[model samples]
Target chain A: MTITKKEVVHVADLARLDLEGEAIDRFAGQIDTVLAYVDVLKGADTQGVSPTSHVISLFNAFREDEVGTHLEREAALANAPDKDDENFVVPRIVG
Target chain B: MKLHQLTLYEAHERLKKKDISSLELTEAVLDRIDALDGEIGAFITVDRASALAAARAADDRIASGSPAMAGLTGIPIAVKDLICTKGVRTTCASKILENFVPPYDAAVIEKMKAQDAVIVGKTNMDEFAMGSSTEYSAFKPVRNPWDLSRIPGGSSGGSAAAVAADMCIAALGSDTGGSIRQPASHCGVVGLKPTYGRVSRYGLVAFASSLDQIGPIAKDVRDCALLMNAIAGHDPRDSTSAPRETPDYTAALKDDLSGLRVGIPREYTEQEGLHSDVSKAVAAAVATIEALGAEAVTVSLPHTRYVVAAYYVIAPSEASSNLARYDGVRYGFRNASGTDLLAMYRNTRSEGFGPEVQRRIIIGAYCLSAGYYEAYYGKASQVRTRIREDFETALEACDVILSPVAPTPAFPIGEKVDDPLTMYLSDIFTLSANLAGIPGMSVPCGFSQEGLPIGLQIMGRHFDEKTLLRVAYGFQNATDFHTSKPKR
Candidate 1:
């Protein structure tokens, strides 16, 4: 399954990566090589066994209800790349 | 002593004995990082003033003869960038999180502080633990101490690189698939991915919530065991945290390999795609175990092959959903502005995520979307069930399973950069553990032709991490592959 340049473009569009020129070429080349190696899946004998979700055999590892202190608004919003009063500021989304 | 050179155990012992103050240990590591970090790019935030303050408190605790705090007081340890450290910036190695200083400590960091472990600094990682190599890190790729040009293995690459480079004695790393184990092997150190739910995930920026787990990376099995003691156990803050009594990991480690029933999944070894060096390393590691009085037997994990495919589908699907919360208004990176809510989401995520991450998010959205859900996401879940059954049955026959951690050692930086598929394939050997949510460890086994480290993975049943540690530590004592270090 050769990942075509088109697929890279599609994936890029889907992933929202802003790319042009060299990055496009680089991602396409890199993704193709990776797909080539993972092609080993084509030869595996997956006959009757179930595909596993977790290796450990525990079920329902839920915790008990507990209350805890959360960070104050000041601390939580301190690291935002862009922020306003007690909230993150961003580009206007709609007309 | 070079600060980065001391193992966690060594540093702790010295601090406990009062031979060296925590401040001295902290200073030494800070100095070492100051001198060599320019070349390796491991630390994201060294926190000198805070680290010294923390060290001073640790020394006070030690001098006061406080039993609990003495355990980790004065030992400098690094945190993966993903783990939130209150007031310290928690960058997932992406511009989206460039300035995201978490308001609180991640659960594990809190545990570390409680035990008196001095904070060395924050190490770099793949933006949001997505990349297989540290190359995807927005800041810089952490070089393998063994070779500055090669990657240390990623997402957790900086964490492992820090340990190997002596940037810190031990570091915390999260493994969604193989992040911790793979890099540990690449850099010739110990990496462990505890069984899912073994360590609390609260405050760990979610990559794939179901598969993600936090674990320890250190110079040897003992260090990992000790660190696990501190971090493992039930935490109410994390709903998925295991409630069972955590075992004494250190107590499980001993020279006695007697009665250890080791299973070698024929499918893992027979896979046509295994690299020759990795195959050889797995085989040799088995032989050494046999010599230690452990019985090795061939077993079948029929669905082992689908682990990677299933993982890509499941992890991304979960990641796509988990990351949806990062849309600008609530938290995380934000773009300049948008006309409305929807536009804000589009613009913010467009600017926040890197290429690979965005790619996964799209694929995840598509697979989990309304029309395609049954075909892709639905089918993947069914496959996930089969994979879990395969391990369950295999474990019934044996206490532990052995395989290669990664298909190969650390590859050249740009070798697979162009091929996302090739990069994904590198995780062939490690993906299963995450998919199955079991405990997996990477133990340095041998070297590649290029003298790069190759790691052997030993997996254990869910919640039965004792066997994994027992077997891994047993292997460590039988060989000296772990003692070798890279010349910086």
Candidate 2:
């Protein structure tokens, strides 16, 4: 149940977060404390209980494929931190 | 009463009678905010020009004497920063979205606009609605109105504090665990978290989708019902929204609880760390309900202890996935130092997000990791099923369950902020209602020995906010707790 500093760094990487030396250790200690506390759930007798991802039972909300009124391109890019006239700008991915 | 201090219903009545203009009321509330918000730190943004313009438009609507004029017409209402407004900066109280303005209004905002409710401003909250105390807000911490040094219970703390301080007539706040009710309890106002699907979540910034719901924070039960009436409805945009019809919540606000069976959960009263003043207040509240002809019964939620544990796993798992959208390319803060895409993503997130948010993301990533998913997230989900069943069985015997909204009243601002587990435990009573997807509300019950407000919690069957409202209305009518305001 104990999360090590190395594991904390790995998890932070998985979450797209950069955790440095002290933050990694601090998060490791904190996460371990929380995990240990939540370990109390291990004693619950949930023998055959089905897991509930959502409380309400909802099916796929299908809609007819048709063009509808939507956000204009200008509005869509209004808040983009880095964007060109037509698209969002980002670091080059494909080498 | 001063125009700023008028309740939503009271203002509506005056507006209907042509006794006062919406412009005057909006001005009064704006003036109050101008005077008090410096001390309260309740609002992140207050748009005076837009609010005044909206009020004038509402005045025009009132002048037209249109038959379609609704109850909320011309009433100024503050929105939580998390809920999107078409052109307003909707920062879920985070640095990442500090400059982000949504292009579209949330479904609730659209509904409120349709009713001609004036938009006053956006209230502060925990960054990404992640913390129990508003101390986690990136902008600033919201102070409790009753005692300035104490924390306003959060992540809806700003909305609750705003309403309590009469900065706005009422407000809309979202609840995942106890965001709405806990703050409402601390601020001595009424708050309701409708059933998971009772209100649409189209633009609520996705905290924990399954557990998150939008509700009201207001001065009393009637105003809560009025706001609920305005916002509670199914929307196609939110696929999880229940297809069922929303009842007129105001019609359900009868002051008689003659047929109501109020259940007192033994585990809640006996739970450790409950403040003695809170216990006494809840006991007196139960007696008051009993005197109003409602029979008090004992009910058991056998999975009570497992709620906080299960919730930490489930909510964070959802949050980690939902928050993946903030990668810096599309809106929000970006770190300019990164030379590559992976570095860009990491640097942007690590810099944009605050410490509490990062802590949660790490916890979520760790729990849902390949090696531990079954033990953490999967086990928690199963325990969630057990928790839901506990409510189902308890509600079968009683019409509504009553308990203390929070174990204690508002604590000092810095008391539990650094201690995440202790802060998490403060929401012990309120999280179960969210896990069970039932409606829960908080009504002012009494005051602590230190003069802090204590609230009584009422929870009812799924999609049955009316019962919770009814019981709360009956209790509020019998007591003056809801009428008592803080002396600032």
Fnat values, one per model, are: 0.46, 0.87
lDDT of each: 0.81, 0.93
lDDT of 1 by residue, B1-488 (tens): 55457777777777767888888888888887897889998888889999989888888888887655545667888999999898888889988788787778888888888877888899998889998888888777788889888988988998899888787878899999899999898989999999899899998999998899999999999999988998998887787887779988889898889898999998877776677987888799999999999999888988776777777778878988888777666566776565666656667777787777776776676567667665556667667777777888999899999998888778888887645666876787788788778789999999988899999899988888888889988999999999888876
Residue B472 in candidate 2, Cα distance off native in Å? 0.6
Q: List where candidate 2 sits over 4 angstroms from the true fold.
A: none
lDDT of 2 by residue, B1-488 (tens): 89999999999999989999999999999999999999999999999999999999899999997746797999999999999999889999999999999999999999999988999999999999999889999999999999999999999999999999999999999999999999999999999999998899998999888899999999999999999999999898898999899999988989888988989998998899999999999999999999999999999998999999999999999899899999998899988687889989999999999999998988887889898999999999999999999999999999999999999989998998878889999999999988989999999999998889999999999989999999999999999999999997
Please list all clashing residue pairs in model 2, or write none if there are none. none
Q: Which candidate is the best by DockQ?
A: 2
Clashes of each: 44, 0
Q: How well is candidate 1 docked (DockQ)?
A: 0.36
Model 1 docking category:
acceptable
Residue A74, candidate 2: Cα error in Å is: 1.0
